[model samples]
Target: MSSSTQPSDIIIGRTFGALFIGVTIAAVLFGLSCVQSFVYFQTHRDPGTTFYKLVVICLWILDALHLAFIVHCVYYYLVSNYANITAPMDVVWSFKLQILFEVLIIQGVHSLYLYRIWIVSQGRSRILPIIVGIVIMSNSGVAIALIWALYQCSMFSELNKIEWATFLTLGTITFADVVIASSLCYLLATSRTEFSSTNSLITRLMVYIINTGCLTSMCSMAAIITCAVMPTNFIFVAIEFLLAKLYVNSYLALLNARYYTEVNTDTNNSDTFHNRHGVYRPELHVRALDDDELQVSRKDLFKHLDDTVHPSRSVKEPALAVTTEMNSFSSV
Candidate 1:
């Protein structure tokens, strides 16, 4: 059979093919996140309150649904009865479910960061929280625009409208991520205590805030650039597909770090600063409060530490440590 396909059509198909690969990788990361989450539940006998458990459960459900929808989109393109029609790419309905799921996942991850900032600030900062809330709402609005674009846009010529949505959504997310990372770093810096151990712990947390926030922010920026440069191409789609995986993985890494930190803290070892890999582990020390004076809840401990102290690592191995340490000061 001989056929002449438009260059644009070929580009679209190739983009979808690349998207399939990206989605597959995302699915694998999702599985890894689930495994980490399960280990977290098993290891931390007293992880947190029921609300935290509920959030984890909801994230699991969202992850499962996200994967399912992506798989369906792939199947539709690769094996469905309408596969020969090239309808999947031309129709908005084909991708709305996946896009919706992506938005929900992003929102959940963003909310977690907001919670971190709120706790770290001890609810004192009025402006930063409001900015984050506004950014989140803006991102949500972009998601709605995306859905509307998908619904109203039925062909390649109409992709211009969706491009605007893509730009706004990704730009807002990147802005929000930068805000989170910078805010955490500032708060942690100001919260440093005179005690070496507590300062070490805060330093560790600052590392994580940088890695996690920078990672997501960078991903979102890359997506925004691609979307802007090649609004009609699928390259942006491929890049954006990984956003959810990054979000889920970053959060899971934090949870796993909490487990390792608890084990180290309870061992009562002097060189708790370094782990088996010789990486500086974040260790916390309670100085002012005598053992009998007050029993500190993890949340209270972080709050009390933040109230009392003020201020203040490397890359390579240290970067690995920061990425590995997921337990924020609140969890400690």
Candidate 2:
């Protein structure tokens, strides 16, 4: 081999090696996501959870497709075109199609977060969620444009021509993530009450939101920086491969968190009062809270404590008043 050809060979190896590592990590995360989805379905059987179940199903399907495309792209370059020096420079169809799946998965997760923000604020803070929604939609638009541009490119070098689209797509996503995390943290912080248990739960939620948001944002930022610094390298493409899986797993993680919250609350309130009158009294109230509709108001908390402390008061007739309040956050 000529001396000059060694540099190109090293680059090809690095590119495919990065692709392999990214896809491997993505597959691991996808497996975790599948487990989370199964747990969600098994634990939450109420009819109200149909929407969330559907969301999980849809995202999982999209993630499967995305992974398949990535595998095909890697196979095309590394296996199908083995020993061909020029193969790395050519673009494959799967490489272009995966962007669409990524955009859809990301949008789905973002929309769910936006819904949570709206619910946490009890529809009072409408402007922030709306603005975030607009930004998310704009990001999706740029991602579509980026996919179209990728489709137009026949060579790896051609990606440089559409750097703007790449930057905008990643930039908007990171921005939205930051905004969502900050908003959730700020809102939850403000909703904190004097109760130690409630405050503790709120703190846990804030920490979780911060961690997940930072994770996805950091991945996006890394992709943007790598793409800008080394447009010819496959490092950015590898990062892109991981982005969708991260979002999907994040969504599933959030959903599955309800189980932990429930267990903790139950352990803490093990001696909770149950009506002993057995006259169909409206004293004991136990309700299952949905993940999306997890709201705990101060009034409800005070009422629950009051009922628990003073269970002597009973209903005049055979009446039942059941109120479902999530143990986690009163306003999360």
Candidate 3:
């Protein structure tokens, strides 16, 4: 090949190669998410979890559609236009429509995280949720603007015209992830109980929250950096293809974690405790509670702690205190 055509060949390789790698990773994540959803529905048959099951179903459908769009875009560029040297520069309809699915998936996952923060803080921390909500909404707007810009342009190189939108969208997403993770960590740390087991569980939850947030944030940062450094390549587009799958998989992981926590809690503690009469008494056997009930249980935990510290001054029987054993992310 002549020297003049070498750069074109390299660009083609990078453009299609990135798309292939991204779609491959996304397919793997999607498969894992499907397994998680199946396990969740098979195990959690309670009426309280119906809403969560529906959310999972919706996300799975969106993810499947998103993957289809990516596949079509790649096939259109690489297979259908195999002999066309200028094919990589042309834009496809699937490329623009995928932005809509991406924005919707992100909105759903971020909303769930916000709800968890609300429950963990017992509705006391309003400022953080409001700020995160605003950022998320702004990001959605930027995504729409980006789609519009893509629609207006016939060539991939034209994306530079609305580069600001791309930067804003990724920046807002990273900001929201960081804020949500930090808020959850702070709230969980402050909710530590006197019992070591309870505190340990809270610490585990904090670590999980941080890891989930960091994964998504790192992906967004990678996309942003690639877009800025190589505006003419499709590496950023490839990263975008994986973003929805990451969000869906993370949400499913959060939900499925409850089963492991419940098993661990039950196995570590005895079902019955000896009372003051030296007789074995059955522990309070309430079903797993949702977020609202979890909040009530937390209050009972604090009240029980107070009574234990000052038994002589207490008048009423102690409230049932098993909040520590319950999974913090049980509902949201």
Candidate 4:
């Protein structure tokens, strides 16, 4: 029935064609999300927002994914780098598979922040500082490894080599991310601390970050599996971009540290004001006490184990709110 390809027949055939439309669309969206998040974080900063710094930390991860996918997209789709895109099906899938884990790492970051916010908001003091170290080590290591793999792949000319190299590396990154991210989630879900609304403002952002990170990980996993098995897909490129965008936009949301908690220490009892993204406001807490109050500033509180006299690791509950000896703010 080769009648110069009838209009109806051509349309039907094209519709059923094996074109990688799904992957292509996803890549574009991921890239845009990353850029959005990146800009969001930079514009948002208030010195008092202690937790927002973590959000800034989140920016680096999203940026990495964005850049990785950018490289992947250029190499696969762009004119000059087109020579690098050749591969059979499953082998080419490694690039997209790798990107999926990268996105998951970003997601894990958001989850960790969310848990912290939840802990602070609830005033649950059970959170130890060491957890931060575990997260930093685990996530950063995988990201570095993945980026290294990408560089290695970039330098190669053959498909088999890229597959052999990236496949194992990506699998390791994914496995590690799942373990640590799950631990963070478990910590948050079981947190018992309950801070007043005074801690609500900034705390809200942290919790929100966690939720966003969770959603991202859940959805990205499915996409990665499909790409890994299918390969030679334009869809992979689009998904990569979209994932990048998600990472970046999430970081941008995190830049709103000022919108959360603001600490004001007076001569007597320290006052805590809990803000919820500049919406619900509350009166400042005023109390009478000695010039010496047990109020810990973010500066005094190291990310984790810096206190030598009473090493926190030894103690189950390390005092983040270290009773300061210095007096900066006077009484009213």
Cα lDDT for residue 288, model 2? 27
| Runs with alpha carbons beyond 4 Å of true place in candidate 3 | 1-10, 47-49, 123-125, 271-332
Error of 2 at 296 (Å): 9.5
**Candidate 3 lDDT by residue in tens digits, 1-332:** 11233336556667788899998998898898889889888866766645577788999999999999998988898899886877766678888888888988998898877766655455365787677678767767777877677688876666777788888888888898898789767866777755555466667667777898899999999999998987767799899898899999888877765455556755433332222235432333342323234434433432321122211121122323444433222222
Candidate 1 vs candidate 2, lDDT winner:
2
- lDDT at 24 for candidate 4? 51
Q: Per-residue lDDT of 196-299 in model 4, one digit per residue for the tens?
A: 22233324534654665654554456446645764333333344345545555544544433322322323124322122123332222221122122233232
Off by over 4 Å in 2: 1-10, 47-49, 271-332
Candidate 4 lDDT score at position 239: 44
Each prediction's total of clashing residue pairs, residues at least 3 apart in sequence or on different chains, is: 2, 1, 0, 39
lDDT of 4 at 67: 54
| Predicted candidate 2 versus true structure: per-residue lDDT over 207-253, tens digit per residue | 77788899999999999999878665678889999999999987787
Q: What is the lDDT of candidate 3?
A: 0.71
Q: CA lDDT of 279 in candidate 4?
A: 33
Q: lDDT per residue, candidate 1, 1-332, as tens digits?
A: 00233333555455667778878888888888889779867865764565555666777888778778777776766667344655543544546677788888888888876766665555466787777778877777877887777777666556665676777778888887888778767877876544444455667767876898788888888888877776655677777778887888777666465455445444533233233345443343321122212212222334322233112211123323332342332234
Error of 1 at 74 (Å): 1.1
